[model samples]
Target chain A: MSGKPVIVFDKVSLYVEGRRFLDRADLVVSEGESLVVAGAGGCGKSFVLRLILGLPGMGRASVRVEGDVVVDGHSILAEPLPALQRRRRNMGSVMSGGGLIENMDVRKNIALPLNYHYGNVMSTAEIEARCDAILGDMELEELALPGRRPVSLNRMERIYVALARALVNQPNILLIDEPTTGVSAAAGERLARFCFYYRPEFPSAPAAMEEMSGRPMTRIITTVELEPYLDFGHRFALLANGKIEEIGDREAVLGSADPNVRELLSRSRKVASPGVDDADSAELPPGGGSCWRRSDSHWCHQGDRVKEGEEGASGRTAQAR
Target chain B: MTALIGPIQGLGAQVCEAFTNAWSLLMFSVDSVAAVARFFSRQGFWAAFRVSLQQVHFTGLEALPFLSLLSLLIGFTVIVQSLPQLQGMGAHGLIGKILVISIVRELGPIVTAMIVITRSGTAMAAEMATNRISGQVEALEAMGIDVFHYLIAPRVIGSMVSLFCMVIYFDVIALVGGFLVASTQLTMPWILYSDYILESLQPLDLYISLSKSILFGFVITLFSCYHGLRAKRAPYEVPMVARSGVIQAMFFVFVSSAVISAVFYWI
Candidate 1:
């Protein structure tokens, strides 16, 4: 069971606008293994995730999730709607903005996955108790009430709510995009530690729900750059254009002088590099997440927009828009 | 004549496409209705209905003041034109009858339909377009929630109810406006106005007018939702959908009003 691959993208390729986005991407991950697939934006980082997620039937490529994507020992493509829903319950994905429902307050939105997946498994008392513990654990003491809608809260608060919602199900797999891209470096480190540290603290949570699906022991396979934004992934796979060039530890992927790997890294730096985008360059705070300004009464974004660094300043990228 | 036949035939084909698309949309609406009924138990029908009511308030009530003002100007202008013509024959007393017939039998429904089409109709389309763009529609779908019921059924119901109420409001204002103009500008006697209005206006006229508005309400909601829900995922598509909604609503109302008038006359 440990050797069984949870997700396997077999020689998959995707094309958009009649031009190939990803030529052929082949990758595999087994239970209890954490991984980070890193590449420049538009270099098919999301394309890889999309195939594993089965967003489209075939994006000019064949995709197969070998062991189980949504549940244990079952192919995601073959599962029924109800079965697929059950699989999705075992996992949750968080985009950079956290995709909070604008109308529902933070608390209700966070409570959603709990109600969807485990309402019957956990009693009313246990559910409330668990929710309370998590809120305190994340230090979201004030936001636990979910009083205000998403629009009112600052960006970091929204990320806190987003992180809280992802953890509500105590999922086996968390597919996250740009986890640290919007928050302060300190907060990003805290988020990275929280996700990486989950393996040890809540080891029992995933096993308890193992009977619902085949795989358990909540493992996170995500995508990120370890040198700057985060530091704790077990594996980093080099992705360039639309293919995985190398798969190894951080030292190997980073230290390697492979032409393709060097090219991919060089290209990633250029994406946010103001030299190419100097036409509309703004001052960015030395560390990147989201760059915006907010006073008590004013939220003006004038001059060169540099990513700001502060407790709440980092995660407000989505809101600053 | 041959050139005329080609375009006329093409128009017949396009109208047929509208009918076919409408039928497809009706089937989709039925599916959503069933899904919404299922979720009704989760958040009681009254609560869901209340949310829908809020949609109407934002979508409907906000536009009423301007619509009423337009109706007033239309009524005053129409009566001004009618007075000189009616007076030429020494039948100036017919002013009230003319106003009543024009306002209730024709202008009320047409104007109401146009307003709903421009305002609520475009609003619904843009909202759905944005929902599609923001992945809200997909979010609803992923929850095993039928989008038609949760996203669209509410708007359809809201548009129908809102359009009807607005038309009634528009009709009332137009009448008062016509009366105010006749009394002040024409120095017409109150008895003449009242007698003419009472003698010419019928319950059937009001019923027919209201009924046409209901049909207008249905068409506006249908066209807007159909185009909006089927929006492209691109950013600019939302604006495109909104523009197309206005055009489609106008086309639908024109055909619907003509058919409705023909039917009323035949009956």
Candidate 2:
């Protein structure tokens, strides 16, 4: 991970109905790094993203926050409205259930940020071109048709449109909440690629780590399941008991002894490695090791550990040849 | 003594809550004004302008037919009933003054505001509440879009403009209806009726009518938005917020209209 910290959570604690949802959680995500925060459902994983955005409430109930979330060298909690808005402009967020504007069609919804921020400087044709490019990259051309409002789209389509809208501005930071929930396995892989190694030119081809040129986009994704994002993210953190309990490199996280982390790892492995009937296959690779399969045609066994030099600079493990 | 203390404490709490709400509403208005100013200086001018035009279309142009019908009925009823009485009392010359006082100065603005409150005001509240409940407001904020600039300001501007135009339309249509009734029933000359009405018309009457309409517009839209945003979540809260907004906006519209008229006429 790079030393430059782009987002820092300093002793951030949140309380809802006197229950501790976050207990002085501290995290630091650097520029061009991908961090996946996984937890059980309703475990306040989404709240962390909200806290980073300096939002006061979750859905309806207001959460009392007692710490600072600093983004791009500005404390979001203390920054004034205008400055905070400017800060948010540099970051893109996808809230749960894909918070697309109901009244606007999918195209308008995706074009909103661009139109609002760059409408004066950019022509309408330029804006439409940008929207069209992002829609194409996200494979959302069909949904971009006029009159396809949020209500008309299903859950997966809504999330995809929301992701497209967030990325249309080419935001430096992307905060996505549960992008793969209730989605098919193939769709989940596409979403993972979009969040991690997105390439506009080859939408279907797997994006190699070396192919991503320039400064990488910082991504902080929260999910109830971690299988989809296992191949991505520089670091994986498990949020349990209102605090980030275990966080480290993929191997370190895979070898953690925390019961909660073990359960999450086991669940993720079970989901990722389908058609395996052996109960031992569902459990974590024995001896604090990690196992991953790139395709169903080939299965890496428990002892097939990744060598130190084999890991990519972007923290991605070597692909199975 | 304890019973009295308990009741007094409850009263104190209620008063405090009322003051808190009033303070919040005042701050919201100030913020909305500031946002409107910022909206002009910032980007996205045309986008927000489009929303404002849509609001104007809904609140003003669409309500024209119903407003016209109601205005005519009111005008005919007033002239049909009051013209004979004035004639019997040898007060035919006072017809213009009476029409100006009752229809132009009072009923036109109030009835127009009532129609707005029923149609546009409730719809705005419900729409805002739905936006809030459905996470659209949060989405906008996340996108760095100001809710006041994009949503509230357009509605406020549209509602005010709509009320102003509707009041003027209501007055003119009602007067025409009055003239029709006077000419048909009493065989009054068109020249005589027009002369009486023109002679009685005053700048002060127009000022009061237009002022009340604008103020009513501000009060109704502000209250509706304020109450609508009060619903933080829950779909059920949308209707409740809309209902409360309508009641509060109607109450304030009446109170402000009365206060403005009393201040102008008496104090």
Candidate 3:
């Protein structure tokens, strides 16, 4: 990770409906780094992403922020609407459950940002070309046809489309919330890879990653389950009791004392070791390949199920390192 | 004293709530006007203009047939009722004056506004509420697109244009239809009828009718959008907001039209 900080959460606290959701949380993510924040369901995991985007929470309850959230050296809480809009232009966000416009089809949804921002400068053909390129990169060219609204797509397809929309702008920073919520574990891994890494096999992969400054896109991904992002994230943080209990490198987070952290680690371990817990391994399909494997000095996992024995799982983990 | 205290407290609370709502609505109106100015001055003019055109098509064009029928019926009724009464009073020459005063100055703008409120105003509110509940509005904000520029401004402009055009259409159909229907009963020349209406019509009458149309348009749309966006997230809130929007828009259209008429004619 680079030393230049792209996002800084300086002792931030958020209260909704007179109840504390975040308590003096401090997080600093540098340029070109991906941070995975893991928490249980309803623990305000999505709220963090909304906070970065300067959005109100889901319901009508009043929300109050006690501390500053600085993104790209600008204090988002203090900025005017126009300044915030300008800042948002440089950042891409994938909301939970794929917040696509319902009336517009998939093509229009993805083309929205480009059309709104560059419609005056770029021709319609050029705009469509950029949208087509991003859709191709996300392997969603088939769904790019008109009349394919978000409601028509499955969860995985919707998330992929949301990703394509987020990346079409070539934003410098990306904020994703629960990308792998309802999809299978294998699909989740692929989605995570698409967010963080650029594969050479995809023709427009460079277009997705190519910012104006030529630096890697900074990403902050929030998930309820840690297994999906374990391989790709540069650092991991455990959120519990309205605070980030543990945040560090993957090894440091894995070795932290937080019970939530421990539970997630144990759950990941069970997924990595198949026969060790047959009950948990049920999520793995019968003819599926081994979920856990060694790849590029990382523990790349397919499914969130534990399949092999502890010895085999540890051996793979050791090899992965 | 204790019993009176409870009632007084409740009344005070209601008053406070009313004031709060009024203040909120006033602020929203100011923000909406400012957003329109900013939208025109900004970069996404054509994109937002396309949305404005679509709104015009939906709000103005689609309602044309219904408006035409209603205007013709109203025109025939007014002329049929008033011409005989004027002839009996030996004031047959006042046909044009009566038509201009009743239809052009009042009924044309008010009735057209009522139709738009029933049709387009409710739709705008419900659509905006649904978009909010579905997270589309939040998504638009996250994408750096101004909600006011893309959504509110287009709807406001479209409603104003639609109401203005519809009022004129209503007035013409009412006058012409009234004259045609009355001619069958009274044996009056078409030229005489036409001359009477043209003579009775004044620039002041036109100004009042057009002003009411534009004001009614602005009030209806602004109220609908304000109520619709008040919906936070729940699915059930959609209908509730839509109903509130329609009620408030109707109320404001009546009140504002009355106030404007009173200012122009009575005061």
Candidate 4:
């Protein structure tokens, strides 16, 4: 870990309507370390991420985010509401559904947090450039509107736009929800790996960076994903029933005989690994989410059975290398 | 370090949004009306009253000159058009009385409502629509400001006060116009015109017009405010709400005007 633990969830327990969501969960996400949380649906994967993101605090009291979620030595749980919100500006969040405003045009939607939170000091022209720069990174310069409606964009397009908004500020930590559920597995894995590819955006507008008040750095505090969706992580953690059952390097986690972790990975509705884009099962063959596609078998097209990277399906790379 | 980018600018934009929203709120009768109930329900009377005064000034007071001009034309046209008919029937002496009845009983109330509808009615609908889409309504709640008290009540009060003043203004202008046109265009002596005015209207005619204006004002403001407060979620809902506010406001104005006219006739 490059720095002391940025977010620590110590003995946190959460229950909703009598269903135990998170039970005495203890977790630590360090700065710049990618801690992938792997679990099946309803296995409290999202709950773990939300805990670190501080989502539960909006309503309940029993579900406590204990320990210290200290970012750069500032503990959020200790700060006042206003101060916490101010600190929240350093953290970027994109919910699984890509919480894009459907009514607003793309440019306006992305610009909202920046414009609204920043106020009006940056002129329209300057803000537009910031949006344009982020749009370029995803090679989505033509696929979307900087100022068009969210509903008009495709699912993946919406996801990228959501990502663009989240990363635009180059925040201290990013808390992302399900990014692989709706899109193709190849596309999904690439989306997660894309984070590994982006370096610090140093050469852009200094005016925007001035607002951030520190060295230009991009960090990934943690990622909540199931075993099937785990792509690139320094370590993987098993989140079962609100508590992290086991956390270790990939080999250790894979080798552990913990029934809780094995049952989670085995019985879990296994999704394809985002890192491996096998070509045999790419295509859907007209109308099928067939067994192969359903259970970790990567496909090229919707059902074509050809190479998964048929040059245009977003998984345009050899996986078995 | 990154949080303080556009502090001054963001606040400026919010203020801009607020004022524009307020301006639109005053433009429609329904919005103004809802703003009334919203005011009392949310804000104490004192705060609402001050906002109402501001609304009255912008919506009703500012509209006076135009209302006066329209009313004057109605008055002159009534005398001129009716003069030929009355003179042909050898009832030329009754021009004054006809002018008085038309101006006081019909033209005054209807014209005032029309002006208020065109100006204020549309404004409120647009404001409400914008607030719905922009999350300004939510911002209000977060800030401990009651959207109803802060936005709607004052509008209703303002619309009523403005509409009332407009009716009076329209009535006076029409009477003056009628007298000027009758004496000059008809070449009738001043004494004849004066006598005609006295003969055409009963004192009760003034009461009927005032009552009609009050009813129209209330209905117009109520409906406008209602539409504004009920802004829907969709973007398309905004224009729809605005159109509905004006249509509903005008409908009530006509209905009230007719009812008041009927009561005057029976009396």
Q: How big is the positional error of residue A92 in model 4, measured in Å on the Cα after superposition?
A: 1.0
Judged by TM-score, which candidate is best? 3
lDDT of 2 by residue, B1-267 (tens): 998999999999999999998898899999888877776787767678778889889999999999999999999999888988988898878878888988998899999999998998888889888888888989998988878888888888888889999999999999989988888977889899999998999899999999888888877888888888888778899889889999988888788878888898789
Better of 3 and 4 by lDDT: 3
Q: What residue runs in model 2 are displaced by over 4 Å at the alpha carbon?
A: A59-62, A199-215, A268-321, B1-5
* C-alpha RMSD by candidate, in order: 10.3, 7.1, 6.6, 15.2
List lDDT for all candidates, in order: 0.61, 0.78, 0.78, 0.61
True contacts kept of each: 0.02, 0.67, 0.74, 0.00
Q: What is the per-residue lDDT of model 1 for residues A1-321, given as tens digits with 9 covering 90 to 100?
A: 245677766566666545565656666766655667777665656555544444432211333333223334566656665556556665656654666767677776676555444554555555556566556656565775646677777776776676667666666666666666555544554465445433212323434455533344333333445443224555667677667765576567678887655654453321342122322222222221112244332232323343344415433431222
Candidate ordering by lDDT (highest first): 3, 2, 1, 4
TM-scores for chain B, in order? 0.83, 0.95, 0.96, 0.77
Structural similarity to truth (TM-score) of each candidate: 0.66, 0.87, 0.88, 0.51
Model 3, runs deviating above 4 Å: A198-213, A253-257, A265-321
Worst 10 residues of 2 chain A by lDDT: A201-210
Docking verdict class for candidate 4? incorrect
- Please tell me how candidate 2 rates in CAPRI terms: medium
Stronger candidate by TM-score (1 vs 2): 2
lDDT of 3 by residue, A57-110 (tens): 664569999898998888998899888998897788999878898878899888
Q: List the pairs of residues colliding in candidate 3.
A: A271-A306, A274-A306, A274-A307, A274-A308, A275-A307
> Please, what are the lDDT tens digits per residue for candidate 3 over residues B1-267?
999999999999999999999998999899889877786878778878888888889888999999999999999998888877887898878888988988999899999999999999999999999888888888899999999989898889889999999999999898888878768877789899889889999899899899889888888889999998888889899899999999998888888878888998899
Full-model lDDT, candidate 3: 0.78
